[model samples]
Target: MSAPAPIPDRHGRAGRNRPGSRVWLFAVPGMTLFAAFWLLPMLRLVGVGASGPSGAMAYLAVVTNRHYLWSLVSTLLLSAAVTVVTLAISSLVGLFLQRNRFPGKSLLLAMLTFPLAFPGVVVGFMVIMLAGRQGLIGALTDKLFGESLVFAYSLAGLFLGYLYFSIPRVILTVIAAAEKLDPALEEAARSLGANPLRVFFDIVVPALTPALISSGAICFATSIGAFGTAFTLATNIDVLPMAIYNEFTSYANFAMAASLSIVLGIITWIALALARSLSGNSVPATA
Candidate 1:
């Protein structure tokens, strides 16, 4: 039999390469980029972390050193808190926006997502303006009871900054996922005597679990590594990002900085991995 004609590609070029032939070449650039950017830097970071006077013990500083340990713990706790709060708030707002149509809906969504335009630094600045010593909240509190409500340089401020940026991304995801939800399922649940909370938990949550997991993981990772916001408002908090910055810049402790960076990246990876595993999909590592 004569050979079949080759399949024409979009460019009208005949498909000349056979499967398992030059397919591997397509991955060469990706592999090279990954190695040059990620793999090599990671290896260098590990080496630098071990090359200090403390040797491999530098990596252990996060646990053996009180300051480092507390910094890591605080970062993890703050990131977790941000993830939970962001998800909860996003869930409510996303459902409301998707399920109901109201006047100024577009305007409301635009306002809700307006924070996405602000970088971490801008968000931090906004928090300071809203809650700083001379902020409106402080002025009001001082006027009312002679006590200014100043928390813009504290962990609370950091949390608010993170939440401001995180909610836009997460709420969008929730709205997109919720768009695919089967209303009949909810109606059936309601018809079967399920209460509001029960129907929500049993019917809605499962449908949105994948999106929630992925977005929560991204939010957690962003909070964990959000250096700009932390740098701006880290006056009273010891988040790991600020600690790493101090080690690298203030003390020139390359080993400690490298170790902290490695630890932070690993923790972020773990969160993404867990989310992927739970969602049965490859969750992205970006916010």
Candidate 2:
């Protein structure tokens, strides 16, 4: 019998190339990009973090030092608050927007989600314009209460800025999740005499839980590392990002800043990882 002929590739070559060679060819670009952009930076950051006077223990400053610890804790708490509030408000608004149709429905949705087009710095500026010393709220309070109420340079302002950006992101996710929900399940629950709240909690909430968890993780991660907003309104706030900024710039404490950054990245990564594992899917997190 004659030997079997070799298979031809798309170019009509006589013989097949190694399968692993094709795989590597397909993967090399991505691997190179990852190494260049992600792996290398991470390694450098780790090395920098460990190069401090405290050496490898520099990372412990996040918990050991008073200011660093407070900043880290405050950032986590603020991010958690933003995540919870964003999920709650977005869930309601997204479901309402999805279920109802009105004359200005499209316009309303555009307005609600318009913030997604704005960066964190812009969001922070908007927050300042709304709550700054000369802002509308301050003016109104000045007229009504004989004193201007300004919060644009404090934690309240940071919270508002975070909430502003977070809402649009979460609402988009919630709307997408809501659109995929099975209407029949809600109808079935209603037919059984389940109240609106009961149906929502039992049917709707469960259905959207995965999306919520995933989006909430993303929101937390984004808020944790949010620099622009914190920078814009950190007069009295002490979020980790602001702290890191101060360390790197004002104090020239590069090692401490690197350590803090590593800690922050680790926390955010763990949150994203847990969400992915729980949801059994990838969730895109904003930096």
Best by lDDT: 1
Model 2 residue runs over 4 Å out of place are: 1-21, 282-287
Residues 1-287, candidate 2, lDDT per residue (tens digit)?
98666777779888754445556688889999999999999999999989988898888777989989989889999999999999999999999998898999999989998988888788888988999987899999999999999999898899999999889888889999999999999999999999999999999999999999999999999999999988877778899998888999999888999999999999999999999888868656789
Model 1 segments more than 4 A misplaced: 1-17, 282-287
Report lDDT (Cα) of residue 82, candidate 1.
92
Model 2, 63: alpha-carbon shift in Å?
0.7
> How does model 1 fare in lDDT?
0.92
TM-score of each: 0.91, 0.91
Query: Can you give the lDDT of residue 91 in candidate 1?
Result: 100
**Whole-model Cα lDDT of every candidate shown, in order:** 0.92, 0.90
